[model samples]
Target chain A: MSISEAVVMNGGNGPYSYEQNSSYQKGVAAAAMDMIKEALPTTLDLYHLPLSSPNPIIRIADFGCSTGLTPIQAIETIVQCLLDLIKPIKEPRFRTLEFQAIFSDLPTNDFNTLFTNHLPVRRCYYAMAAPGSFHGRLLPTASLHFAYSSCALHWLSRVPQEILDKSSRAWNGERIYYVNSPAGVVGAYSAQFGRDMEMFLSARAEEMVSEGLIFMVVPGEPDLVHDSQTTLGSELELLGSCLVDMANEGIISKAKVESFNLPIYFPSEKELKQVISRNEFFHIERIQTLSHLKMHVAFPTPESRSLCLRVALEGLLCHHFGNELIIDDLFHRYSLKVAKSLFFLKPESHESISFSV
Target chain B: MSISEAVVMNGGNGPYSYEQNSSYQKGVAAAAMDMIKEALPTTLDLYHLPLSSPNPIIRIADFGCSTGLTPIQAIETIVQCLLDLIKPIKEPRFRTLEFQAIFSDLPTNDFNTLFTNHLPVRRCYYAMAAPGSFHGRLLPTASLHFAYSSCALHWLSRVPQEILDKSSRAWNGERIYYVNSPAGVVGAYSAQFGRDMEMFLSARAEEMVSEGLIFMVVPGEPDLVHDSQTTLGSELELLGSCLVDMANEGIISKAKVESFNLPIYFPSEKELKQVISRNEFFHIERIQTLSHLKMHVAFPTPESRSLCLRVALEGLLCHHFGNELIIDDLFHRYSLKVAKSLFFLKPESHESISFSV
Candidate 1:
């Protein structure tokens, strides 16, 4: 799925609507804050010197700032780091330092909460909402000192429509990246991802001051094509089957459902580094996978398992499964099946990555 | 680490081990033999029939099965429906089919790997491992029928203490369970894994004439955790500092290293269920977790990250900080300062399970 679609799907009232809710979103914000707090020291060690110089004010941006929570977290961490750095020095030295923070996301994202709710609480920091997809036009050249994003970069704009067609049989039970999805669809998605990544790095490169740091958390697999279990293909298959079943039951038309696809990608660690390396300005300082985080949120119980499946389907699956199916019934049945499946379903092995450049 | 140590550290190795060169372990094994091919379908559907029968052959067992691989995976998808039957079938058709598969681990295990590896596999089979470590003695009341086990459950005896404590850490890096170890060690090792799991399960249950099946796959997770990045806690911290200087000097720690931990676990989906459920006479159909399987094999790359230290040392740092430092180098240095934090590590997840009874 594409970033835009993920935002829209996530934004729409769905099972994962909790992610958009203020309370649940606060957890995300808090987690991001914790991550940033943990990452800031090294980030400062690398970028602080360049940023604190008598040069033009250093600008920083957060790409794919969904709900603007991660940026808020980053801002909070940076603020704390800056306070600590400046507190040790004289007031005169602190007065000479200038910093600007910018948050960017899809034009459709909600930034009001960030400005009205989060920014006002902090002092001596400037925040702005730069509207546009991170993959598209969003920032100016050499305008940023550092960049940060979390749990948002892997979103694609939309599901590949071709995969949903009945004739395509892309939704078959086989666990794979499309039941023979045409090279074109796969290429389009790959190119779009590559393009988005290039845009992300290039945009950051252009916007970031020399020797700037970029810390991001993205979902990834270890091996790309070789690992079937890590791929979303199986989940997609289950989702497709759910949708097809709905369509067959006359709950929704096949046509309406044939144009949707999932918009997320879990890149492998190799794939992530390869993308980062493509941009010369960003040097990787560290990269690691957080396996437990995903596990912590998964399959707490049979009900929770169904809830996750429903959330995944409604928020991400519908975009790929098409909208023709009666989402409510499909979700109900899907939840039942999921609950049943949970009885037999083994624990999921999920991995996430945190990287800094 | 040897199987014994792994058993101690992470619980016990589940089920059996495969001969590294076993043809039955290859992908071609299914095509090579009808028995193997039929194993999954027949065992998977076994629960669909009644349990009691005039035929007097309901109990089943998979002997010499190293950590029930085939059984759990085959039965997980269908175990729940099998367990909810309200009435026994007439003619006792398959009613006597009280199925159980006992998984045996070394006496030293805390049941960590069994829990990590076999538990999920059991969940898949809508079953749970018989609580408690499967070593020493099996329960005396149960009877097992149709026993089977592959490559593993055949280690001759214990891994030699000298080899385990070898002065060279590299010695631990070698695949001791296979050809790399001495003939005596291999024979002794193979026989032990076999005898332990087999004798333990067999003692608890009796064999039946109903023609049960046991299929297994072993010789797994070859990538032992030995590389510098895999080590965590004080060990990892020391190594990281050592590596920084080593990299500066262009030297590798080829020597001066002593023993390292392997943290190995076995119990393919089949063996876990078979051994733990005690031939299903005690009510367990499947058990497995595959996430750890892939995880155990995944090597950390520069781009991949590890959180082992944070998880392992969070408490230690907290104790020293004594609430004076909300976040400090003690916690953030390795995590944030050196760029060697949990943020960059990427480890694979495992999944396994079994089904019976």
Candidate 2:
């Protein structure tokens, strides 16, 4: 297939709606924001610029900004950190700073919520909506000072239609997680990741100032590529099993779903570093695995756990699988299996944390 | 442009003839073989099988096994490792072992050398050469036990012509190397690395057995991605500067040269792991940055360094500037620069090394 065809097939238009309205996505964004909050002091230190300094206006952009909350949360954290950092420097130091924030998403994304419900009231932030894929050119050269993206890089533009076509077995008739998935399907997904990451870093390198800092928070496994027992892998297996059971029951005809594939790819920390290191604009400031944080929110209670799974299903599975399957039956099976699976309920021994300056 | 067009444009008989034909490739093959030798004892320890075990035939393949000694060295290493491991074991253990090694390269590569030079010696070792791009599928399901590739994987099948077309200044007459170059030309190389690595690991996962091992040696930087002081980065800058100089002198017409780009990519160890970990079949038993090793071989001496630059000029520059400039001013200037620049002659800190399984 040509890259153009591949782009059209894998572009983030379909199934992405899951992330658009997903409560789990919101939680993930919030957790990501918390990490951004912790890193902001360091980010400011590395950039060596006062957030409140009015000497020069600083502009920030979030590519693949999704619903814009990810960036909103990130900006909020940055502001809080700036406030904390400037508190000791006196009010005079704070009065000299000027900041501007830009939130970007696909032209097709709903921007009403961002403009109406989310923009911070007190902060001096301006919103400009960009309506194109970040995988290509998104911003002008050296136009951004700080950029942030969370929980959205993994979704390819769209699942390849070849994989989604009924004649193809590459899809295997379900929206399973990545592990134990077909090789071609995996290749397609990985290729999309490779392209997306390349587009991301290249664009950022050109758009960011020499010392600009880019902060990214996305779902990941530390070494899941090598070890299938990792949380991401197990989650994929669980999803696959659920899909397989549905296929076995005749609830969903195999032919209708044979080639259907999801556009998700959760990279490990090593993978993320590889992507970061290749661009050479961003340096590793820190990396933290927030899976523990995710686990905390995901498994707080049985009701919460159910809500989390429901969010996951609605955001990830339902987005891909649609409401065609027996929701109750599929949900019951998925919930029981996920509850028993340590990957879903247990907090990993390590927290996912990472920083790049 | 479609992938088919990209493949056709990037895919050719093969580029890099000097290294392809030089003892350097032989050395790379030997070094890879040495890694296999050292790891063989452990590999046997894990498998508890003898070199001659017939119960499960030891099937091995090398992805991107370019027309060099990688496969020959790997086969030799594996055979020697297995034989040495079993020499002290019981006869029953030895009697049950059988081994098969497959060497794969692009359909355009010269496989005759692999068959005639390497595979003839061992009666017990079965050898077969397959023609296809390793980045695409080339093996049967669960058909390989051990896979090894070195240096070659870094080279995408061909440089993406879209970036090279004169209309696109992406190459700026330097060709795809800057686009694909690990350093200096553009950081987009990282994304390319990620994509190539993803294809590599995903393809291998399906080809490898349950307990398969893959040992790969690739060029990489240990520091964060943004550091441009690395040897690879310097080399790219040198090349880019040289091209810019050529353009300034009007030795090469800007429009003709700007229409094409270089296609080359080198990855860091972190990037390699990210690629490998994406697939569950292989675990990273060990990873080492062999920048020192590559540096040692890449610049064996001041004369060798000059020769390397000359080759680059001839292979890459001559096409744009024409033979007249290459023979007259380009060679002399490049040679003089090489002689004057103490840094090129200095023992490089970043020598290429092997990352073993």
Candidate 3:
């Protein structure tokens, strides 16, 4: 599908949107703040050039900044870390330092809300928004010092070509995702993720100053499982079941169900590390998956989980089906499914990766 | 009056606003564009350090950028000029140059329109908004390349203190402006302008790279004029007369009329240059007043003039008077006054000045 026709979050303050149900995102962002603080000094130390001889402005870009307050929290974290690092630099020339933070997302993202509602409250750095996809170059050559993305890289630039071709060995027949697909289908999905990640890293490498760093937080699958037991994985399974049941009842066409494939992927830790190794634009400083349960005892309830999930996926689903699609009914059934399967659901692990460019 | 209490332009796309009556401003901006294009190459050459040895990003700032399309045109002019200059520089390292344009205005300036409506269509440079008064530091130390302000500097940071002091010799009795006022009132206005301009230059000096340039387009009176002969000056006189007539008919309180004073001033060319020399932050390169008559043969009509004046001053007026004030009636009267006085109206020359830090 063309990018313009693809799903985006419900814009502004719409109900059941990423903008409205953003508590989960805020929690994830808060957890990532410590990791960002830990990584900043080491990242700045690796730069060969001094800070303020020619340019006192340090540049950073946040990829996949959908309409929410999370980008504001993320920016404050990065800006504060930079301030702490710059405070001790005894060089007189480095005394006057400033920061430039650039926020990037798809063209359809509600950047107006980000600028009007979120940016006015921010004070640490000069704020900018660059509207584009992160899988390609969004800034000038070697202009970035640090690049960040939180819970956004799971999206593929486009649906894998192999899945769309019914003749291919990797054809995902009558399924919307790779959860229970054939070996060939799984391989195609993995290959696509690798390609997209490679492009993402390569573009950043070209845009970053030498020794710059990138920090990303992505939804990760639990190890030793082909089918996901994590809440996110299970939720998708539930959503898929709803569609299947609709198809079974003739409420939706079976052919339509078969043709639909979500442009989302959740890689295991091993798959993520392998992609990094394949694309040598960055040296992996650290990579770890933190359990949400271990960090916060009160895991997101089914209702909250469904709201968050709907906010993230509703735009895409609406685009694929129709704007008039019965999203509320779909989510209502998915919420019930989630509640019924609550005890069996495993809390998802968030993958945090830090690397030097 | 406190800045927080003073009226700003009617924000967004209101009936009569900066966004609505911006053609004259645009025409003035186009004239200033030539002055900017002429100054940039010479200013860049004067910098001891090259454009992108340590910092590859060139920065320009536009002060008083409320919600309007004029800023976009202004930025495009500056960016296009820089690109032209950078094209001939064969140095391999300088080939990858980028531009960061910062737009600044008051906290209440309609930046939402700037970001949402105007910025998205712009692709040449990275866009940023710095929210603050220009009379104070709005950027990091030595961080700007070029600073431009057109039709904005006349606004004082706050109403002159003497105007508010009823017992002072400069107390402006039953007048909203200094024109045709007592000698003390003119001195008070001139003193306030001098102070504000000094602060503006001093802050720019600290924020600009050595030999960085500043191009300002401000309203100016012809030589040997204490009271302004400009259209802006005459309109204010007309508006003041309307208020006076209302006061005479007991339609409004006489004390309310006496308490009002506009926080705006249009300086003469000699006065402008004198203040720049006094501050000693910038060396004057070229300062000239261009006749509006020579530039545009058909001066703005009374109807057009009233609309333009209302857009610029209505917010401030509404704040001082009650929001219920019949602004239409006031402008209608003012428009008639303008039409009757048209034959004696002297077209004001806009002052254009370029200086190097």
Candidate 4:
């Protein structure tokens, strides 16, 4: 979708409604726990901070923290794990060090819901909100101890310029996403993710203390014969077909479908390594792709699994076509398309990566 | 002055023009350096924070940081003194620890001037702004390391309700301040200060770690024979007479002058000690009164000295009268009155006090 019209998870009720359909985020948050634990020991060992230092307060920032209790829930897991790791240490001074947990997101995020109604009364850390974009500097230099973001890195800062220009070679015609699109369209999305990632890393390098750990859960192409050969690719292809079919049926205009493109990309392992190695600020610790079918094993039906994708994409669809677009009809048809694709296509994959700087 | 109508020094120019007439605040900031140093040794000793601790960043908060470069200047001094104190400890881990300087004031305070256009780069510590009032909780509980406030504690969160009530015995009639007012009116202001101090100490107790050093510079009565015997008291008395004479001349309504009272108080030495001792959270560290004339050696001219008072009080007067009131006329009359009083009146005493909790 256009930058100004970029729909974020349905601000109102819909399948893509973050409030009603965030089980996917909850699952992603659960999977991120192990990665956080693996990164903590090295973070604690390498950070040469003293207990009696001027600001003996630990700062943990959760960027792209969406509305709901999940953000706090995720922080509690990290804080509790760190506490356990520190409890065994014999330093009495460490007990007095305070934790300042800063939860940040876009200015439009529901901070009132996050801080006023949902924040727990007896949190181990001091809770505060820094409302801003993560693509730029949010805190002061060398301020953060640990940074964590879940299911958020895939979204680009904005629609790539080449894709939006009608005369540009990268114009994404007849498709709403990069996956399964032409090479030119795919290259444009990849380029935007690379630029956004560079900005993100630079801002983070200035903010993090030496050897601070960063954990990000990203949707990526699984290791296979071809990078785009995955079930998620088929799912997006079917969803695109549904939109085109709607346009043909005169339910929506063809130009409307062409104007809308999801500001997201699923980077392959090679692409991720190229960007990470290019920026010497961070040393890659680990990169692993988790299977979508295995991750969604708790859901016994295809519709349940498809709900996760629909909840996230509905906002962009509704914003571009019209807010009056029937969300239930859209998702119901989309779910059937996904179920049909699954009959012949394989399950897709999502990846998680860690860094230390 | 009504809260909404308070025309704080011409934000662009005039006495309260923090940009032009902050010599008085600068003097107070300089005088505060010694107290901060004294409190630092104890604060560093009792805090028990380790340099290599999890969150080794020291947090120093400057409450009531009005618009100007003085706040930065004052914080640089504190951060430098602190760095010097910590340098001799010989802990390698201390090298990585950073300081976070938080500048806080009322929401309307010129934070834009303090942060965006004025903040210095390549400093020793991280800088940020916390926009809120200090009377209630501002920072997270147990989050602060060292707290300092100068020439600001005199402002009460709200004017005393008793003085505002026309039918109450404590109603301050024909007076714009408590200095030399009727005993009941003076007692109302005193009572308000006591209550506010209690709330202030309690909130700080919850927000500060055990044994955090809090340095406060309060303007109060010296060890004199009479309450109004101080120079500051006489200055206020002279300013009050100017307003009364103006009301008599129909320059301003008599009722207008009677309805306005500054939400400020210069407590006596006895009153200062009583409040600290009453609250168990803090121990009185030091209390001393310095002569305003001696403090303002840089300001040799009577008008220069009067400008300090006029800059701070003009907003209140404009809020009480109309914003359209001629500031030059008001301050000219007030300056002449101050010059006349200085001919015979002893220089006023302004006290400074520090606390450790």
For candidate 2 chain B, the 10 contiguous residues with the lowest summed lDDT are: B4-13
How big a share of the true inter-chain contacts is recovered in candidate 1? Answer: 0.00
lDDT of 3 by residue, A1-357 (tens): 354325556667777767777765666677688777776676567336434454466887888878678887788788878777777778665565678788777656776566656665437676666656688777766768888888788888877878878899888877788777777877887788889899999999988888688898876665565633333455566788888877788767777777778888788777788888887778778787643333122335667767777887887777776643477878888878877774325433422222212
> Residue A331 in candidate 3 has what lDDT?
83
DockQ for all models: 0.00, 0.01, 0.17, 0.06
| CAPRI quality band, candidate 3 | incorrect
For model 4 chain A, where is the 10-residue window of minimal lDDT? Answer: A348-357
- The CA lDDT at A280 in model 3 is 73
**What does candidate 1's lDDT look like per residue over B108-195, in tens digits?**
2222222234444213111212222233232222223333343333232344344355553324432323233344433343334545
- Models ranked on TM-score: 3, 4, 1, 2
- Taken over the whole model, the C-alpha lDDT of each candidate is 0.43, 0.55, 0.72, 0.67
Q: Which candidate is the best by TM-score?
A: 3
lDDT by residue (tens digit), candidate 3, B1-357:
335324456667876767877766676777688767876777666225345564477888998867788897898899899788878777765666678788887755676566556665437686766666788777876778889888788888777888778889988888788877788887888888999999999999988888688888877665566453443465576788888887888777778788778888888777888998998778888887543323123336777767777887777877777754578888888878877774325543422222212
What digit string (tens of lDDT, one per residue) describes model 4 on residues A1-357? 244224344433344457566765676676677656665676566236523354356778888887677788888888887787777767655756677777776544544345434566556776655545688877766768788887777788877778766788877788777666567777787888898889889999988888677777776665452544444455676777888887788777888888877777667777887877788688787766533224345333668756766766765666667754566766777777766664323433422222212
Where does candidate 3 chain B have its weakest 10-residue lDDT segment? B348-357
For residues A65-87, write the lDDT of model 1, one tens digit per residue. 65534456667677666567566
Candidate 1 residue B255 C-alpha distance from true site, Å: 86
Question: Model 4, DockQ value?
Answer: 0.06
Best by DockQ: 3
Clash count for each candidate, listed in order shown: 137, 67, 2, 24
Please give the lDDT score at residue B339 for candidate 1: 48
TM-score of 1: 0.42
